[model samples]
Target: MNLDQYLPVLLFIIVGMAVGIGPLVLGYVLGPNRPDDAKNSPYECGFEAFDDARGKFDVRYYLVAILFILFDLEIAFLLPWAVALQDVGLAGFIAVLIFLAVLVVGFVYEWKKGALDWE
Candidate 1:
């Protein structure tokens, strides 16, 4: 295999890394070293923390967040499938329909399990 084919990819990766790391290097070098009590203290919207930062939270919060992300990502697949609907033809359409049906079933299951209920 010709190594020349990979030169552009190598250069692309090097440039990408430099672009990402350059600003961070410059900021550390040029930024002032300043640390005050106000800056170091734990703050919450201009007020001091009233409770422990490691306080336990309700499991429902996490469950709801995960469900939202799961459904959100599943929905995102629709966009690409929609854009290429013409090229994908009947088989692709049926596949997306099956995917949607499964998504609906999962949603109904979650709903029946009281996961969607908020007290």
Candidate 2:
């Protein structure tokens, strides 16, 4: 088979690699060499790193993070549904309504259990 068919793909790969690596190489070559104590120090924050990196955190951190991801991804479904609203008609509308109902129920459950309370 002729390799001409793959010319665009080869060019795309080369360009993609250049775009990804060019900035990194340029930064290493041209960036400042300043490395003072504050810059080089293990600064987790202005405050010292109190907790061990591997220390067991309270489950609330994971719970909050998972909840954020869940709601964030739930919104992602809206774009496709909005685009295909006419094609999907009533069935799609009802399906989304049911999905929303379940989400609300879960939210209520979490609220009742005080999982959403900060303090």
Top-scoring candidate (TM-score):
2
In candidate 1, the residue pairs with backbone N, CA or C atoms under 3 Å apart (3 or more residues apart, or in different chains) clash, namely none
Highest lDDT scorer: 1
lDDT of each: 0.89, 0.86
Show pairs that collide, candidate 2.
Answer: none
Instruction: Write candidate 2's Cα lDDT for 11-113 as tens digits.
Output: 9999999999999999999999896776656563333444467766678878999999989878898779989999999999999999899999999999999
Give all TM-scores, in the order shown: 0.59, 0.62
Poorly placed runs, candidate 1 (over 4 Å): 1-49
For candidate 1, lDDT tens digit of each residue in 1-119? 99999999999999999999999999999999898776767663444544577876678878988998998998699999999999999999999999999999999999999999987
